[model samples]
Target chain A: MMNTKSLYQEVILDHNRKPRNYGVLDHPSHHAVGHNPLCGDRLDIALNLENGQINNIAFQGESCAICKASASMMTAAVKGKTRSDAETLIQEFREMAMGERDLNHPHHLGHLTVFSGIRDLPTRVKCAILPWHTLHAALNALSSVSTEADNDPVQNAASHPEALNRQANS
Target chain B: MVSANATLAKVTPRINTILDTDKIRADFPILDIKVGNKPLVYLDNAASSQMPQQVIDRLVRYQTAQHANINRAVHYLSEVATLEYEHARRRVQQFVNAQEDREIIFTSGTTDSINLVMHGYGRKFIEAGDEIILTTLEHHSNIVPWQMLAKEKGAVIRVVPINDAGELDIDAYEKLFNERTKFVSLIHVSNALGTINPVKQMIAYAHQQNVPVLIDGAQATPHMTVDVQDLDCDFYVFSAHKLCGPTGIGMLYGKAALLEAMQPYKGGGDMIASVTFEETTYADIPHKFEAGTPPIAAAIGFGAAIDYLCSVGMDQIAAYELDLLNYATEQINEIKGASIIGTAAHKTAVISFTLDGIHPHDIGTLLNEDGVAIRTGHHCAQPVMQRFNVPATSRASFAFYNNKTEVDALITGIRMVQKVFL
Candidate 1:
């Protein structure tokens, strides 16, 4: 059996209890609400992107521990990165969470290795990557992200494992 | 010799055949399986129930020997299948005490049953500016369909509020009915909170105002006997799977006169008497509502499930489950920071609860490690959660087959969850 303890490590709990950048943005250039209808977890991602870089990124919503932790880690990780670099970091993180990449050799996802054990718990894989997918939609300027969408980004993650791997290796 | 006599004395009180749960548990084979290393303690019966071997055997018998299309063939298998299907309808009629067998219309499940009434009755009779009375305790299945009809027909929906204890306010429900009231659809028992609504009195009041009432009995039929005749509800709906039958089959019990007044919900093969390119004449009562080749084997399995429940008796089941609920409530209340959501004066064998500082999902995950199954979410009744000021709840619902030992396991599992969070 895979270790559930690894999935809910101390760092994850810390991030959940005192989440970083956990509020609304005043006037954001990019914003999107992500919803998982299965558990009624709704997350709104808002960022002020200036000069092709994320000036500030914050999120506000109600979600489970995994989602809340992932969103907090995401905002802290991508706040100083350019939009293109942020997208690349998201791809790498997706590959790691999907177990397509080894945790020992993560490219740029620093503290996000706390979620590497998510792939073993299939149902919770959605919770772990919900905010990252929402970030992807926000960077693309889509108004919303939904598991119910016909072409959901979550589905894309499962369908395009090779793409995630290619982006991770690059 | 002395020890043997003492053992007999200890076991004498638990030997009542009316609620012979030890014997009843042996009938369900899946109950013996282990989840991890721990024995499986299934408390998610409200979401769906475990099937007994009798129902499984009946399904196998239908598929092995009695598989054929009904009403369209002259073959022996077709006739046998048709007889079994209609026999299942009669069984449902007797179970619910409906006036006639023809009044039982088989659909996919409870959601499908409500959607049929929305399309068949609401679309036909409900006009613009009319009012439909619904309660806050309704499952989304009952709420969404009416909201769609209200949106399309320009009709208005008046919601009856519930008290803090999750019981519907009877005075508020009476006031909601006015001259514009065309219909009322209410849940007989709340699936989320397990509060058995005062449906009989509500039905009587609706009858006085000359409004037809539909009762969503999906949560009620499994826990108690539902008599559509005694309640005098115009329509009653429930799913088979919630009562230890197969999925993809449910029955809608509507009064014959009201059923005849409504239009057919779907147009297809079995539902039509004759079909031409110009016009199609629909079939009689139940057939007009049930379109296409229905879930035949499932219907037979539903009959078998009803037989199984009748053998044990619903009243016995109700009594045993109430004892289980009280034991579990008392045990759970001992945990520090544990709070139960629904505290209605009257309820079935369901307990929705929350622990301080631990998310419901986290609690559910930890409980799964102990092989104790409970549902954690809004329970498909977001309105109930919202009204209770909770985002979600962990619900452990009981069935007749459940024992006191399982409730002890649940309490231990909840304590483990709290310990991890603490």
Candidate 2:
């Protein structure tokens, strides 16, 4: 039996109710809009990067509890981290949420693993990953990102390692 | 509130006498299945309905005893299959009260049926500058095909707007017709909102200008009685899956003359009088439109579904479903911060609603934990969503098999959703 109660823990509910870093950043270095056309979840991620480190990060969007909470936690986790480190966290979070990364294996995901429940719900995996996808788009200076299979930047990055390298260098 | 309760109490006994919902529910095996340690409360009939045992048995019987490629064979199985398939066509023709049996063409489903007309009729008759009238209440199946045709032929597409209650603006619909208007396509019942459009009146208005009208009856046929001849709609399309039958089979009921005049949408085996490398003459009305080998078994299952529905009278089903809708409406309205999206004067048993702070996706996910299956999203009617300034809505669409107990379960599930969010 899939435990939906485990999915909607107090942490998630609290985050959804009073999201942290829930605003647009002024004079942001990177910004991107994320849309999950499936559920009409839309998120705008804006971050200010100073000396290759994220000085500030914020998100404002209309999304489901899973998505809004994921966005809230993602901004808190990546702020003040180096761009490479933030990118590494994004990769790890995506792998964990997709059930590809075994929790027994080494990872830096920490409390972010609460979203692992999303793996059981195939329809909601995109909800948990949309914010991370938007972060990747923001880091690469892409204007927008979508969770739709054809337009997903994360899937595009995985299938083409060369594209990931190109995006990182750019 | 007391008077409302009184009205509900008075209506329930009359409805129960008309239709024994308990007996009807027993015919569906899926309604007995448990989901996540809870009994399934299916409220997503607007998307697709559950098949009764009769339809399922029909499919099994066809596959086991009488399965073969239909037409073009003198083999025993082939003849049986062809006869059964054509018999299914007659059942559908009678179900919708079409004038002729030859008028019904089996397509993949509602979307495919609309596309067939768009290709066969629109492509031939509609030229540049011709206007096609559609409404905000249309499903994407009804709207997108016309939009595609308009784009391809440089034809103008006019839209009739809806009021806040999601009813089509009748005056606006009437005004959309003009000398330039060549065709009108609209939804009979809104899948998302449950608003039953005055399609008969609208069809009559269009015919005054000689513009042919096609009613997308996908959502209407399952819930109410449909009389094609009485409405005098030139074309009507619906899917069998929504009527407790198998998927991948639906009917497109076009007037015989119009169907004969239109070009064939697809050309292949079984839809030809004779084939030549240079040119091929198409067969008569229905076969000309249904090219290639159709889903023969599913068609027979559709006929069985029709028989099953006829056994449980449409009037009885409509009255019972209306009571369920009313009871649900009264209950959901009592919940603060939960607003029903479409509150039209006349509707089927569909309730599209929104919670003040909760997304419909979250509502749907939480409701599933309680085995309450609903549809949540734009419902392929983004224009309607935009009209109401909502991105998406959580919809609970009821069928005749659903009882008030399931509606109560849905209400409880909604409260559970609210508690989790809180």
Candidate 3:
């Protein structure tokens, strides 16, 4: 198990205490609410996309320190990046949280690697990943996302929109 | 820090000596194991308790000496297994003080027991326009089954609201009952808040209206003595795992008349007298409900768990746990930013609290670092969470085996959680 000390380091604590970009965007082009039903953590991600580049992003919700810190760091990491670059960061963060990618290997996680300790706690992985998942949903124009494995229609629709479309048509 | 230590030292000596808690702790082998470098302070008894060696030995004895499918053949092992299983039923009957052994039906767990009643009695009796009265304090197991029944039968479900103190609103509960009220199911104790509800009075009121009531005793049975006859409840359900027994086995104590009147929940071997192509005859009462080969070993372990609890004496257990609760509550109340959600006048050894500016999940993860295990979530009682207006609360539920020191560890752990966040 990763040291709990390392897991709740000063950087993560600072982000949780005073999360940056923490508010609703004014008439955002994209918005989604992320829900972790297992722990009752909810995150609202709203961002404005201008000319295929992320302009302004803000998050506000009731979540644990890990999730709040993740959201805070996530908003900072992808503020000025293009949509594709933001998606790549989301993918990398997911991999890092799930222990799919080794930190020793070259990656673009940057200072967000502070959350690398989350992989040791299976229950808290969703806490660290919910923000990224909501960001994914917001970018795709999905209104909501849930971490619940069984009833996550948002995940299915996002992963296979054509399949969902076919079903809806049928 | 010195004053805190001094206060703890003063309280430690005052801990109720009713149950030799140290001796009781020795029975549960898991209590000795270390979590990381620290000793495990397990305060999550409301979720599931650790089993004692006595119950473990009983399971081993049954599997090694008397392992066979019950009621199948005239073989020697079958008779022994069948006898032991029935003996376990008698133990359960005595445990809940049910009138007869036939009143106790072995179920998979408390959820299965509730679902069985919903299927057997609910599907058969409840009709459209009828109402089933439930409480906001109910676990999902007690609520969802009735919901499914209500949806299928076009029946309505009326919920009893709780006060801010987490106690059931008795006047509101009494008012919810009317001519349309058909059934009532409520929790004996709030698992999320540890409020010991006034169920006996509610049951009496339900009886006056001729509406049967089912008490979800999953949280109560582990703490106090529950006499179904004394309470006059129509049905009482609880899980063995909560009482330091094996999982996958629980008891549903229904009044014999109700059990006999209800349709069979499941149909298979052992629950039938005879089967034919055209007609099938079902067995009587308890056998009628216990369809397939039951969890023989788990049931036996459950009986052993009952035996162990009885030896410890439920009254003594209750007294000792109350002392622990008092100490823990006193300590937690002293914390600056922590606020307890459920402050009911009557409660078991459960404290659900939230630290200011820190979520319960964060509190739980940090506490685990100091080897303190607590439940941090909705606790399968979302209605209670919604009523309290919190996403979730960190809960520390105490069992008889837990001592004042464990409670102190939990308090220290909470302080550490605050420090980490700070």
lDDT of 1 by residue, B1-422 (tens): 23323443454545534366777899999999998788999999999999999999999999999999988799999999999999999999999999899999999999999999999999999999999999988899999999999999999999999999999999989998889999999999999999999899999999999999999999999989889999999999999999999999999999999999999998888998988999999999999998899999999999999999998777667766777787888898899999999989789999999998777887787788899999999998999999998889999999989998999999989987766655
- TM-scores, chain B, all models: 0.96, 0.96, 0.96
Overall lDDT per candidate, in order of appearance: 0.87, 0.88, 0.89
Evaluated at residue B143, the lDDT of candidate 2 is: 83
> Which runs of model 2 end up more than 4 angstroms from their true locations?
A142-170, B1-16
Question: lDDT tens digits, residues A28-105, model 1?
Answer: 677777888887788877787889899887786788888888888889899978999999988988898888997666
What's the interface RMS deviation of candidate 2?
A: 1.1
Q: Return the TM-score for candidate 1, rounded to 2 decimals.
A: 0.90
For candidate 2, give the lDDT of residue A144: 33
Each prediction's fraction of true contacts recovered: 0.31, 0.79, 0.79
The alpha-carbon deviation from the true structure for residue B133 of candidate 1, after best TM-score superposition, in angstroms, is 0.3
CAPRI verdict (incorrect, acceptable, medium, high) for model 3: medium
- In model 2 chain B, where is the ten-residue run with the lowest total lDDT? B1-10
